[model samples]
Target: MRFDQELIASMVAPNSRVLDIGCGDGSLIGHLSQEKGCDAQGLELDMKAVTQSVAHGLPVMHGDADAMLADYPDDTFDYVVLQRTLQAVEHPRDVLRHMLRIGRSALVSFPNFGHWRLRWHLLRTGRMPMTSVWPTPWYETANIHPCTIYDFFALCEEDGYEVCRWMVVNGNRQSRLAGCSPHLANLFGEQGLFLLRRRTR
Candidate 1:
């Protein structure tokens, strides 16, 4: 499993329900099922990925995050996850709203656009930065709404969502203490993962 997948799986409670959005090839879902003993399923936009996942004996459906989430009843899963695909979604805010509504908690992981390397590259080279985590060039990239860690937190605040826990990781996706600080993480961390829920009004 990838480093982010390991961290995400660690956050999940054993034997709980999990729904993984944009689950490419179903590796994480399979890992969660075998290692964490969780009931896991996936929704993938790519039909090829869906087919591959099913052939591997994983339960994954062909669906889009923007539309399919509304079909699920509220509180349907213990955790709903959107990993590395938030920036690629058509309507991120709406997708997040539905995620938090249908699950007790939501786990999100995304590349941090505010990382020092990205900023430095942009400032020095005067072009979009490409790194190990964000390897795509701007023209062919799927990311339409890349955001910073601070930006994501601000959105959570504005939407009345409570950040339960958050972590910032290096390019290799290893969580480090220096990356735990909000300011430092925004500057140095390559990616961020957040666990959130709707705040009780």
Candidate 2:
């Protein structure tokens, strides 16, 4: 599992039902089912990844997050997870709405576009920044809506979603700024992970 997947797995309760969106190769799904005792399933757009996961005896289906998420009835799973796929989705807000509607909570992780390194690189080179995380060139990348930590918070607020928990991590090391304000996290964090729920009246 990737670093974000580990953190997401830690957040999910044992024996809960989970739906992992864009679940590449079903690594997290396997981990969640075998280790956490959760009923984990996955939806992936890549046919090759779907085949690989199915070959491993994992319950993963080929599906698109933007189109297929709305087909599920409300609260069908305990959790809906979208790891590192938010920016690539066509309608991120709609995807998030569907996710929260179909599950008790949502787990989201994405690269932070407001990281200082990116800012510095853009300022220094006056071109699209390339790093280990955002390595793809602008013309070739699927990330149409790169966003910051503060931007995510604003979106959650606008949609009446409660941020249950959030953290910032770089590589394998968790940033101390995760406990601090979003300003700090936005400036320093490489990626942001958030656990969110609908704001109940």
Candidate 3:
């Protein structure tokens, strides 16, 4: 399993329901089912991924995150996961709102746009930086709303979402950075993972 997947799995409660949006090949969902004994399902926009996941005996369906989430009733799941797909979604804020409404909590992960390496690369090259997490050229990349860890935290605060837990990890080093300071983590970490829930009034 990927390090992020392992981290995400650790946060989930055993035997709880999970819905993975934008799940690629259903690997996380499969792992969660086998290791955590959770009733996990997935929704993928790519039909090819959906087919491959179903062939592997995983419960995955073809759907778009932006459109399909609205159909689910309130509190239909224990956890809704949107790993590494936040920047690619059409409307990230709306999707997050729907996810929190449909599930008790949401797990979101995304590449950190404010990493020092990326900043340095852009500063030096005067163009979009392509790192391991973001390998494609600017035009070919799916990320339309790349954001820093600080940006994400601000968004959560503005929307009144409670951040239950969050971590910033160096994918290459396989080390987790201190998340107490978003500025420091955003400058060092390559990726970020967050567990969030709607704040009660």
Candidate 4:
């Protein structure tokens, strides 16, 4: 099956053991296992997704991301990925800490709320702007923290981690522009992917 979750796909290391937080249907993990030679496991909350993952012969557990990571031994894998789970989560900071503690690196992504179109929608139309990547109605969107890309960086700084790589894809990477044009860029190119490593004294 084809997949579009670039945020997850870009950071996963070939032949490394991986634990995907909120790994819906195990699509990315399956690809990593087959194509990249990685050993993959998934942590998913949806039972349907868990079933689908199992049927595909991928290892998965039916559990919450915030709750499940606590049980794993510290730094147990090459990567502990939290793709698009930060916004939907109730405690983003604590969740991030645990993710950092449990793995050498992390792959994290979220819809950037500070995109120009979202700004325009709020400034002119006074509503949460829904785009292709984030096609949620204002009331129905699961993005509790609807944060900007900068906000994410600031959090990483505060938590003593740093973004090692970043890629912004608006359907394609060829369309990306220089920093924060607010007019020339695609807002729906809303996804931000980063590889993070924790800093130590």
Clashing pairs in 4: none
The residue pairs in collision within model 2 are: none
In order of appearance, the predictions have TM-scores of 0.95, 0.97, 0.95, 0.88
lDDT of model 1 at position 70:
94
**Candidate 4 whole-model C-alpha lDDT, 0 to 1:** 0.77
Clashing pairs in 1: none
Lowest lDDT 10-mer window, candidate 3? 171-180
Off by over 4 Å in 3: 172-174
Whole-model lDDT per candidate: 0.91, 0.95, 0.91, 0.77
- The residue pairs found clashing in candidate 3 are none
Q: Top TM-score: which candidate number? A: 2
Every candidate's CA RMSD: 1.3, 0.9, 1.3, 2.7
Model 4, stretches more than 4 Å misplaced?
1-7, 172-175, 178-189
lDDT per residue for candidate 2 within 24-118, as digits (tens), equals 98999999999999999999999999999999999999999999999999999999999999999999999999999999999999999999999
In angstroms, the error of model 3 at 160 is: 0.7
- On lDDT, the stronger of 1 and 2 is 2
lDDT of 1 by residue, 1-201 (tens): 788888899999999999999999899999999988999999999999999999999999999898899999999999999999999998999999999999989999998999888999999999999998788999999998999999998999999899998998775657676465888879887889999988997
C-alpha lDDT of candidate 1 relative to the true structure: 0.91
